[model samples]
Target: MTFSLVGHCAETGQLGIAICSSSIAVGARCPWLQPGVGAVSTQNITLPALGPQVLEHMACGLSPTQALDSALTRNGYSQFRQLAAIDYRGRTAHFSGSETLGCHHTLPGELCVGAGNLLAGASVIEALVRTFETSGGQLADRLLAGMQAAVAAGGEAGPVHSAALVVVGELTWPIIDLRVDWADEDPVGKLAQLWAAYRPQMQDYIVRALDPTQAPSYGVPGDE
Candidate 1:
Protein backbone atom coordinates (compact mmCIF):
# COMPACT_ATOMS: atom_id res chain seq x y z
CA MET A 1 0.00 0.00 0.00
CA THR A 2 1.18 3.49 -0.78
CA PHE A 3 0.49 7.16 -0.03
CA SER A 4 2.54 10.05 -1.27
CA LEU A 5 2.60 13.88 -1.44
CA VAL A 6 4.22 15.95 -4.22
CA GLY A 7 4.21 19.72 -4.15
CA HIS A 8 6.30 22.81 -4.74
CA CYS A 9 7.13 25.67 -2.38
CA ALA A 10 6.40 28.90 -4.16
CA GLU A 11 7.91 30.97 -1.38
CA THR A 12 11.27 29.21 -1.28
CA GLY A 13 11.43 28.29 -4.94
CA GLN A 14 11.87 24.67 -3.97
CA LEU A 15 10.08 21.57 -5.20
CA GLY A 16 9.63 18.57 -2.97
CA ILE A 17 7.63 15.47 -2.12
CA ALA A 18 7.04 12.96 0.70
CA ILE A 19 6.00 9.35 0.37
CA CYS A 20 5.09 6.52 2.76
CA SER A 21 4.19 2.93 2.17
CA SER A 22 3.14 -0.26 3.87
CA SER A 23 6.22 -1.68 2.26
CA ILE A 24 9.49 -0.75 3.95
CA ALA A 25 11.94 1.94 2.81
CA VAL A 26 9.80 3.43 0.10
CA GLY A 27 11.50 6.79 0.60
CA ALA A 28 14.90 5.53 -0.44
CA ARG A 29 13.47 4.25 -3.69
CA CYS A 30 10.61 6.56 -4.55
CA PRO A 31 11.63 10.19 -4.20
CA TRP A 32 14.22 12.06 -6.32
CA LEU A 33 15.16 15.57 -7.38
CA GLN A 34 17.49 17.96 -9.28
CA PRO A 35 18.39 21.25 -7.64
CA GLY A 36 17.04 23.85 -10.05
CA VAL A 37 15.16 21.57 -12.41
CA GLY A 38 12.37 19.86 -10.43
CA ALA A 39 11.36 16.90 -8.28
CA VAL A 40 9.77 13.53 -8.88
CA SER A 41 7.89 10.87 -6.98
CA THR A 42 7.98 7.46 -8.59
CA GLN A 43 5.71 5.23 -6.63
CA ASN A 44 3.12 2.45 -6.89
CA ILE A 45 5.13 -0.31 -8.49
CA THR A 46 8.17 1.74 -7.55
CA LEU A 47 11.26 2.17 -9.73
CA PRO A 48 13.84 4.12 -7.73
CA ALA A 49 16.08 4.60 -10.73
CA LEU A 50 13.53 6.42 -12.80
CA GLY A 51 13.20 9.16 -10.22
CA PRO A 52 16.15 11.21 -11.39
CA GLN A 53 15.54 10.52 -15.04
CA VAL A 54 12.18 12.20 -14.74
CA LEU A 55 13.98 15.33 -13.63
CA GLU A 56 16.46 14.85 -16.42
CA HIS A 57 13.67 14.78 -18.94
CA MET A 58 12.29 17.99 -17.52
CA ALA A 59 15.68 19.64 -17.40
CA CYS A 60 15.91 18.95 -21.10
CA GLY A 61 12.82 21.18 -21.39
CA LEU A 62 10.09 18.60 -21.38
CA SER A 63 6.73 19.69 -20.08
CA PRO A 64 5.30 17.86 -17.11
CA THR A 65 3.06 15.81 -19.32
CA GLN A 66 5.86 15.15 -21.79
CA ALA A 67 8.32 14.20 -19.11
CA LEU A 68 5.86 11.88 -17.46
CA ASP A 69 4.85 10.41 -20.76
CA SER A 70 8.42 9.78 -21.82
CA ALA A 71 9.40 8.23 -18.54
CA LEU A 72 6.42 5.94 -18.36
CA THR A 73 6.63 5.03 -22.00
CA ARG A 74 10.16 3.75 -21.57
CA ASN A 75 9.12 1.29 -18.93
CA GLY A 76 7.87 -2.05 -20.17
CA TYR A 77 5.32 -2.22 -17.39
CA SER A 78 4.04 1.29 -17.69
CA GLN A 79 0.52 0.25 -16.85
CA PHE A 80 1.47 -0.21 -13.20
CA ARG A 81 3.30 3.08 -12.75
CA GLN A 82 2.35 6.05 -10.64
CA LEU A 83 4.25 9.31 -10.95
CA ALA A 84 4.16 12.97 -9.91
CA ALA A 85 6.31 15.75 -11.27
CA ILE A 86 6.84 19.41 -10.39
CA ASP A 87 8.92 21.42 -12.81
CA TYR A 88 11.29 24.26 -11.99
CA ARG A 89 8.47 26.70 -12.55
CA GLY A 90 6.10 24.71 -10.36
CA ARG A 91 3.83 23.45 -13.09
CA THR A 92 2.65 20.04 -11.95
CA ALA A 93 1.29 16.82 -13.39
CA HIS A 94 0.47 13.35 -12.10
CA PHE A 95 -0.69 10.02 -13.41
CA SER A 96 -1.80 6.76 -11.81
CA GLY A 97 -1.43 3.88 -14.16
CA SER A 98 -4.45 1.81 -14.93
CA GLU A 99 -2.60 -1.27 -13.74
CA THR A 100 -1.46 0.20 -10.43
CA LEU A 101 -1.21 -2.40 -7.65
CA GLY A 102 -4.89 -2.15 -6.80
CA CYS A 103 -7.74 0.31 -6.62
CA HIS A 104 -5.34 3.17 -7.23
CA HIS A 105 -6.45 6.76 -7.65
CA THR A 106 -5.06 10.28 -8.01
CA LEU A 107 -6.02 13.83 -7.12
CA PRO A 108 -4.38 16.74 -8.92
CA GLY A 109 -4.52 20.46 -8.22
CA GLU A 110 -2.85 23.52 -9.66
CA LEU A 111 0.60 22.74 -8.26
CA CYS A 112 0.27 19.49 -6.37
CA VAL A 113 -1.17 16.01 -6.34
CA GLY A 114 -1.79 13.09 -3.98
CA ALA A 115 -1.65 9.52 -5.24
CA GLY A 116 -2.20 6.12 -3.72
CA ASN A 117 -2.64 2.46 -4.46
CA LEU A 118 -3.87 -0.52 -2.45
CA LEU A 119 -5.22 1.94 0.06
CA ALA A 120 -7.86 1.33 2.72
CA GLY A 121 -10.37 3.56 1.01
CA ALA A 122 -10.99 5.51 -2.17
CA SER A 123 -11.27 8.91 -0.52
CA VAL A 124 -7.69 8.87 0.72
CA ILE A 125 -6.18 10.80 -2.15
CA GLU A 126 -8.86 13.45 -2.09
CA ALA A 127 -8.49 13.92 1.63
CA LEU A 128 -4.76 14.42 1.14
CA VAL A 129 -5.37 17.10 -1.44
CA ARG A 130 -8.00 18.87 0.62
CA THR A 131 -5.88 18.98 3.74
CA PHE A 132 -2.89 20.16 1.76
CA GLU A 133 -4.83 23.15 0.43
CA THR A 134 -6.32 23.92 3.84
CA SER A 135 -3.06 23.74 5.78
CA GLY A 136 -1.89 27.18 4.60
CA GLY A 137 1.83 27.40 5.25
CA GLN A 138 5.23 27.12 3.58
CA LEU A 139 5.79 24.39 1.00
CA ALA A 140 7.29 22.00 3.52
CA ASP A 141 4.43 22.67 5.92
CA ARG A 142 1.90 22.06 3.22
CA LEU A 143 3.72 18.93 2.08
CA LEU A 144 3.74 17.59 5.63
CA ALA A 145 0.10 18.56 6.04
CA GLY A 146 -0.71 16.71 2.88
CA MET A 147 1.02 13.56 4.13
CA GLN A 148 -0.97 13.86 7.36
CA ALA A 149 -4.03 14.36 5.25
CA ALA A 150 -3.52 10.99 3.62
CA VAL A 151 -3.00 9.24 6.95
CA ALA A 152 -6.10 10.80 8.47
CA ALA A 153 -8.03 9.53 5.48
CA GLY A 154 -7.03 5.87 6.20
CA GLY A 155 -3.67 5.72 4.38
CA GLU A 156 -2.38 2.34 3.25
CA ALA A 157 -4.25 -0.90 3.54
CA GLY A 158 -1.89 -1.84 6.35
CA PRO A 159 0.28 -0.02 8.88
CA VAL A 160 2.80 2.41 7.47
CA HIS A 161 6.48 1.43 7.52
CA SER A 162 8.40 4.20 5.78
CA ALA A 163 8.24 7.90 4.93
CA ALA A 164 10.40 10.58 3.23
CA LEU A 165 10.43 14.27 2.24
CA VAL A 166 12.94 16.00 -0.02
CA VAL A 167 13.16 19.68 -0.99
CA VAL A 168 15.90 20.66 -3.42
CA GLY A 169 17.40 23.65 -5.16
CA GLU A 170 19.15 23.69 -8.57
CA LEU A 171 22.48 22.57 -7.13
CA THR A 172 21.60 21.53 -3.61
CA TRP A 173 21.79 17.81 -2.86
CA PRO A 174 18.62 18.09 -0.83
CA ILE A 175 17.46 21.24 0.87
CA ILE A 176 15.24 19.55 3.47
CA ASP A 177 15.25 15.83 3.03
CA LEU A 178 13.83 13.92 5.97
CA ARG A 179 13.47 10.20 6.01
CA VAL A 180 11.63 8.05 8.53
CA ASP A 181 12.75 4.79 7.00
CA TRP A 182 10.45 2.92 9.31
CA ALA A 183 8.03 3.78 12.11
CA ASP A 184 5.81 1.78 14.39
CA GLU A 185 2.67 3.64 13.44
CA ASP A 186 1.52 7.07 12.35
CA PRO A 187 4.63 7.57 10.28
CA VAL A 188 3.40 10.84 8.85
CA GLY A 189 2.90 12.45 12.24
CA LYS A 190 6.28 11.24 13.36
CA LEU A 191 7.76 12.74 10.22
CA ALA A 192 6.21 16.14 10.86
CA GLN A 193 7.49 16.16 14.42
CA LEU A 194 10.95 15.30 13.19
CA TRP A 195 10.76 18.07 10.63
CA ALA A 196 9.86 20.64 13.25
CA ALA A 197 12.71 19.60 15.51
CA TYR A 198 15.26 19.45 12.70
CA ARG A 199 14.11 22.39 10.59
CA PRO A 200 16.47 24.92 12.19
CA GLN A 201 19.36 22.51 11.99
CA MET A 202 18.48 21.71 8.43
CA GLN A 203 18.54 25.39 7.60
CA ASP A 204 21.98 25.69 9.18
CA TYR A 205 23.21 22.64 7.30
CA ILE A 206 22.13 24.01 3.95
CA VAL A 207 23.67 27.39 4.67
CA ARG A 208 26.89 25.70 5.67
CA ALA A 209 26.84 23.51 2.57
CA LEU A 210 26.38 26.51 0.32
CA ASP A 211 29.29 28.41 1.81
CA PRO A 212 31.21 26.04 4.03
CA THR A 213 34.32 28.22 4.28
CA GLN A 214 32.32 31.01 5.90
CA ALA A 215 31.65 30.41 9.59
CA PRO A 216 28.99 32.08 11.68
CA SER A 217 30.99 34.81 13.40
CA TYR A 218 28.38 35.40 16.08
CA GLY A 219 24.97 34.22 17.10
CA VAL A 220 23.69 32.91 20.44
CA PRO A 221 26.57 32.23 22.83
CA GLY A 222 28.65 29.18 21.95
CA ASP A 223 26.87 28.77 18.64
CA GLU A 224 29.34 31.32 17.31
Candidate 2:
Protein backbone atom coordinates (compact mmCIF):
# COMPACT_ATOMS: atom_id res chain seq x y z
CA MET A 1 0.00 0.00 0.00
CA THR A 2 2.87 2.34 -0.70
CA PHE A 3 4.16 4.55 -3.51
CA SER A 4 7.68 6.01 -3.53
CA LEU A 5 10.25 7.85 -5.60
CA VAL A 6 14.05 7.99 -5.19
CA GLY A 7 15.74 10.87 -6.95
CA HIS A 8 19.13 12.51 -7.46
CA CYS A 9 19.71 16.18 -8.20
CA ALA A 10 22.50 16.45 -10.74
CA GLU A 11 22.90 20.17 -10.29
CA THR A 12 23.42 20.11 -6.52
CA GLY A 13 24.60 16.56 -5.95
CA GLN A 14 21.66 15.93 -3.64
CA LEU A 15 19.76 12.71 -3.08
CA GLY A 16 16.17 12.44 -1.90
CA ILE A 17 13.08 10.29 -1.56
CA ALA A 18 9.36 10.99 -1.35
CA ILE A 19 6.90 8.34 -0.25
CA CYS A 20 3.25 7.93 0.75
CA SER A 21 1.17 5.01 1.90
CA SER A 22 -2.12 3.84 3.32
CA SER A 23 -0.08 2.47 6.18
CA ILE A 24 0.90 4.57 9.16
CA ALA A 25 4.42 6.05 9.66
CA VAL A 26 5.61 5.05 6.21
CA GLY A 27 8.55 7.42 6.65
CA ALA A 28 9.94 5.70 9.71
CA ARG A 29 10.43 2.45 7.83
CA CYS A 30 10.92 3.15 4.14
CA PRO A 31 13.37 5.90 3.04
CA TRP A 32 17.11 5.62 3.54
CA LEU A 33 19.86 7.96 2.36
CA GLN A 34 23.53 8.77 2.88
CA PRO A 35 25.08 12.02 1.78
CA GLY A 36 27.10 11.59 -1.42
CA VAL A 37 26.01 7.96 -1.56
CA GLY A 38 22.44 7.29 -2.64
CA ALA A 39 18.73 7.06 -1.78
CA VAL A 40 16.85 3.83 -1.21
CA SER A 41 13.22 2.85 -0.58
CA THR A 42 12.27 -0.53 0.81
CA GLN A 43 8.59 -1.31 1.10
CA ASN A 44 5.92 -3.91 0.19
CA ILE A 45 6.77 -6.56 2.79
CA THR A 46 9.01 -3.82 4.25
CA LEU A 47 12.33 -5.05 5.49
CA PRO A 48 13.55 -1.76 6.96
CA ALA A 49 17.12 -3.01 7.12
CA LEU A 50 17.33 -3.32 3.39
CA GLY A 51 17.45 0.45 3.05
CA PRO A 52 20.73 0.72 4.92
CA GLN A 53 21.95 -2.59 3.55
CA VAL A 54 21.56 -1.39 -0.01
CA LEU A 55 23.19 1.93 0.83
CA GLU A 56 26.16 0.17 2.35
CA HIS A 57 26.73 -1.63 -0.90
CA MET A 58 26.46 1.62 -2.84
CA ALA A 59 28.96 3.30 -0.52
CA CYS A 60 31.31 0.46 -1.29
CA GLY A 61 31.32 1.53 -4.96
CA LEU A 62 28.53 -0.71 -6.30
CA SER A 63 25.99 0.64 -8.73
CA PRO A 64 22.36 0.97 -7.67
CA THR A 65 21.43 -2.27 -9.45
CA GLN A 66 24.38 -4.18 -8.07
CA ALA A 67 23.79 -2.91 -4.55
CA LEU A 68 20.11 -3.80 -4.58
CA ASP A 69 20.86 -7.18 -6.04
CA SER A 70 23.56 -7.91 -3.46
CA ALA A 71 21.31 -6.88 -0.60
CA LEU A 72 18.30 -8.86 -1.83
CA THR A 73 20.38 -11.96 -2.33
CA ARG A 74 21.01 -12.14 1.40
CA ASN A 75 17.31 -12.07 2.23
CA GLY A 76 15.37 -15.29 1.79
CA TYR A 77 12.11 -13.30 1.84
CA SER A 78 12.91 -11.21 -1.23
CA GLN A 79 9.89 -12.61 -3.01
CA PHE A 80 7.59 -10.39 -0.93
CA ARG A 81 9.61 -7.16 -0.79
CA GLN A 82 9.75 -4.18 -3.12
CA LEU A 83 12.83 -1.95 -3.29
CA ALA A 84 14.39 0.87 -5.34
CA ALA A 85 17.66 2.78 -5.34
CA ILE A 86 19.37 5.78 -6.97
CA ASP A 87 23.09 6.16 -6.54
CA TYR A 88 25.15 9.37 -6.39
CA ARG A 89 25.86 8.91 -10.07
CA GLY A 90 22.12 9.15 -10.78
CA ARG A 91 21.92 5.56 -11.97
CA THR A 92 18.69 3.85 -10.85
CA ALA A 93 17.51 0.33 -10.06
CA HIS A 94 14.44 -1.40 -8.63
CA PHE A 95 12.89 -4.76 -7.71
CA SER A 96 9.21 -5.67 -7.48
CA GLY A 97 8.67 -9.03 -5.91
CA SER A 98 6.23 -11.46 -7.51
CA GLU A 99 3.84 -11.04 -4.58
CA THR A 100 3.55 -7.24 -4.64
CA LEU A 101 0.03 -6.05 -3.89
CA GLY A 102 -2.79 -5.16 -6.33
CA CYS A 103 -1.64 -3.23 -9.40
CA HIS A 104 2.07 -2.66 -8.83
CA HIS A 105 4.96 -1.57 -11.03
CA THR A 106 8.38 0.10 -10.98
CA LEU A 107 9.35 2.80 -13.43
CA PRO A 108 12.86 4.15 -13.91
CA GLY A 109 13.46 7.69 -15.14
CA GLU A 110 16.43 9.98 -15.65
CA LEU A 111 18.12 10.17 -12.25
CA CYS A 112 15.08 8.68 -10.54
CA VAL A 113 12.99 5.57 -9.88
CA GLY A 114 9.31 5.27 -8.99
CA ALA A 115 7.67 2.23 -7.41
CA GLY A 116 4.33 1.34 -5.95
CA ASN A 117 2.19 -1.55 -4.73
CA LEU A 118 -1.58 -1.74 -4.26
CA LEU A 119 -1.88 1.29 -6.49
CA ALA A 120 -4.77 2.47 -8.62
CA GLY A 121 -2.83 1.60 -11.79
CA ALA A 122 0.56 1.63 -13.48
CA SER A 123 -0.21 5.23 -14.38
CA VAL A 124 0.56 6.20 -10.80
CA ILE A 125 4.17 5.18 -11.22
CA GLU A 126 4.29 6.75 -14.64
CA ALA A 127 3.02 10.08 -13.38
CA LEU A 128 5.56 10.00 -10.58
CA VAL A 129 8.54 9.68 -12.91
CA ARG A 130 7.11 12.04 -15.52
CA THR A 131 6.35 14.79 -13.03
CA PHE A 132 9.75 14.55 -11.38
CA GLU A 133 11.43 14.94 -14.73
CA THR A 134 9.34 17.96 -15.68
CA SER A 135 9.24 19.67 -12.27
CA GLY A 136 11.67 22.43 -11.31
CA GLY A 137 13.38 24.11 -8.30
CA GLN A 138 15.05 22.26 -5.44
CA LEU A 139 15.33 18.50 -5.28
CA ALA A 140 12.90 18.40 -2.37
CA ASP A 141 10.29 20.41 -4.25
CA ARG A 142 10.57 18.18 -7.30
CA LEU A 143 10.14 15.09 -5.16
CA LEU A 144 7.06 16.50 -3.49
CA ALA A 145 5.68 17.59 -6.83
CA GLY A 146 6.22 14.13 -8.23
CA MET A 147 4.35 12.65 -5.29
CA GLN A 148 1.46 15.10 -5.69
CA ALA A 149 1.19 14.22 -9.38
CA ALA A 150 1.17 10.53 -8.62
CA VAL A 151 -1.69 10.99 -6.21
CA ALA A 152 -3.63 13.01 -8.75
CA ALA A 153 -3.08 10.33 -11.33
CA GLY A 154 -4.57 7.75 -8.92
CA GLY A 155 -2.73 6.95 -5.73
CA GLU A 156 -2.94 3.87 -3.57
CA ALA A 157 -5.94 1.55 -3.87
CA GLY A 158 -7.11 3.15 -0.64
CA PRO A 159 -6.60 6.40 1.23
CA VAL A 160 -3.07 7.39 2.16
CA HIS A 161 -2.56 8.02 5.88
CA SER A 162 1.11 8.98 5.99
CA ALA A 163 3.78 10.63 3.86
CA ALA A 164 7.45 11.66 3.99
CA LEU A 165 10.00 13.77 2.11
CA VAL A 166 13.72 13.34 2.73
CA VAL A 167 16.74 14.99 1.10
CA VAL A 168 20.45 14.83 1.82
CA GLY A 169 23.27 17.04 0.64
CA GLU A 170 26.94 17.08 1.66
CA LEU A 171 26.19 16.40 5.30
CA THR A 172 26.04 13.38 7.56
CA TRP A 173 22.32 13.97 8.20
CA PRO A 174 19.33 14.76 6.03
CA ILE A 175 18.79 18.42 5.17
CA ILE A 176 15.07 17.76 4.67
CA ASP A 177 13.31 15.05 6.64
CA LEU A 178 9.66 15.93 6.96
CA ARG A 179 6.93 13.41 7.66
CA VAL A 180 3.23 13.26 8.36
CA ASP A 181 3.41 10.04 10.29
CA TRP A 182 -0.38 9.72 10.53
CA ALA A 183 -3.09 11.99 9.25
CA ASP A 184 -6.76 11.35 8.76
CA GLU A 185 -6.63 13.02 5.35
CA ASP A 186 -4.30 14.64 2.82
CA PRO A 187 -1.06 13.58 4.44
CA VAL A 188 0.91 14.45 1.34
CA GLY A 189 -0.43 18.01 1.39
CA LYS A 190 0.38 18.24 5.07
CA LEU A 191 3.91 17.08 4.35
CA ALA A 192 4.27 19.72 1.64
CA GLN A 193 3.17 22.40 4.09
CA LEU A 194 5.75 21.22 6.57
CA TRP A 195 8.44 21.52 3.91
CA ALA A 196 7.31 25.02 3.03
CA ALA A 197 7.72 26.14 6.62
CA TYR A 198 11.02 24.35 7.02
CA ARG A 199 12.67 25.37 3.78
CA PRO A 200 13.61 28.90 4.85
CA GLN A 201 15.16 27.66 8.06
CA MET A 202 16.90 24.61 6.56
CA GLN A 203 20.18 26.39 6.01
CA ASP A 204 20.04 28.07 9.41
CA TYR A 205 19.63 24.75 11.14
CA ILE A 206 22.65 23.42 9.31
CA VAL A 207 24.62 26.48 10.33
CA ARG A 208 23.55 25.97 13.93
CA ALA A 209 24.86 22.44 13.76
CA LEU A 210 28.12 23.35 12.12
CA ASP A 211 28.84 26.63 13.93
CA PRO A 212 26.64 27.95 16.71
CA THR A 213 28.20 31.43 16.74
CA GLN A 214 27.51 31.95 13.05
CA ALA A 215 23.94 30.70 13.38
CA PRO A 216 21.07 33.15 13.46
CA SER A 217 18.88 33.83 16.47
CA TYR A 218 15.95 31.50 17.19
CA GLY A 219 13.61 34.56 17.31
CA VAL A 220 12.09 33.09 20.45
CA PRO A 221 12.01 34.55 23.97
CA GLY A 222 15.64 34.59 25.06
CA ASP A 223 17.10 34.92 21.58
CA GLU A 224 15.15 38.06 20.88
Identify the leading candidate in terms of TM-score. Answer: 2
What's the lDDT for candidate 2?
0.95
RMSD of each: 2.6, 0.8
Residue 143, candidate 1: C-alpha displacement in angstroms: 0.6
Cα TM-score of candidate 1: 0.90
TM-score for model 2?
A: 0.98
Clashing pairs in 2: none
Off by over 4 Å in 1: 213-224
The digit string of per-residue lDDT tens for model 2 on 1-224 reads: 99999999999999999999999999999999999999999999899999999999999999999998999999768889999899999999999989888899999999999999999999999999999999999999999999999999989989999999999999998999999999999999999999999999999999999999998998899895
lDDT of 2 at 122: 96
All candidates: TM-score: 0.90, 0.98
Mind giving the per-residue lDDT tens digits that candidate 1 earns over 108-167?
775777788988887888888788777887778888888887787778887888888787
Whole-model lDDT, model 1: 0.80
In model 2, how many backbone clashes occur? 0
